[model samples]
Target: MASGSKWTYSQNKRFEDVLAEYAEDTPDRWHNVARAVGGGMTAEEAKWRYELLVKDVELIESGRVPFPKYGTPPGEAAAAKAAARTGRRG
Candidate 1:
């Protein structure tokens, strides 16, 4: 895969699994993560991807991005209305 290519769902899942195996203080953590993630990803790419994931989590936690409602069908206005009435952010 090219350096600029986006990660596939499987690749992202593998990355997350591998990341959990390697702690932040682990030596050569990025290299290990890249090797585990495979798909021709380099250490820098794995590190960058992790950083992006962290930023995404931060945004959601800060309410800058709405939390996704899983299993909600498209055009489900009723769910949104119910959530609004219950004072829930989604």
Candidate 2:
């Protein structure tokens, strides 16, 4: 995935857990969190993903959108496109 774009559930969960280990208001905290996430994640990417998650969660909680589950296509259109690419039936 691109930086400043989508984040997987595991990534987000790891970010949350790792974020708590840092002291309150630590400078360069996002860099540490990115390192903790591993897989060549950049600090800017981690910070952007975290902020995106917060906004998405807020929208979901407020009934603006449904909560997203891991590994599921965003919608039927996406699912159909994926199925076509994989030559699989939906």
Candidate 3:
């Protein structure tokens, strides 16, 4: 469950979905994947499931893309501050 040091509910969910889809054994299925985590999946695994990460990152990034609201601006500084106070880097 603790996929990595930065894994969150959404990240874990994305990882699980990627695993399930990849397990289907359909190389052409083209699943989403992201290297958003430090060690949830190996580099090969992330590359194999690149689509899953794309989707996950898309979803996460979309919240602030074009214009980040909620005073979160989608920056490392804000993220770091948030993480320090709430343990959430994203």
The top-ranked prediction according to TM-score is 1
> What C-alpha lDDT values do all the predictions have?
0.82, 0.78, 0.53
Q: For residue 50, give model 3's deviation from the true position in Å.
A: 13
Question: Taking the tens digit of each residue's C-alpha lDDT, what string does model 3 give over 2-33?
Answer: 33355555565566675565554655333233
Q: Which stretches in model 3 have alpha-carbon errors above 4 Å?
A: 1-4, 28-90
lDDT (tens digit, per residue) of candidate 1 on 7-87: 665666678899999999999999999888787788998888889899989999999999856454444668798889999
User: How do these models rank on TM-score, best leading?
Assistant: 1, 2, 3
Model 2 misplaced regions, further than 4 Å = 4-9, 69-90
- Candidate 2 clashing pairs, residues 3+ apart or interchain: none
**Predicted structure with the largest lDDT when compared to the true one:** 1
lDDT of 2 by residue, 1-90 (tens): 467556666666677899788754988988888788887888888788778768988999999998766565357669889899999996
For candidate 3, report its TM-score. 0.28
Q: Which stretches of candidate 1 lie over 4 Å from their true place?
A: 69-90
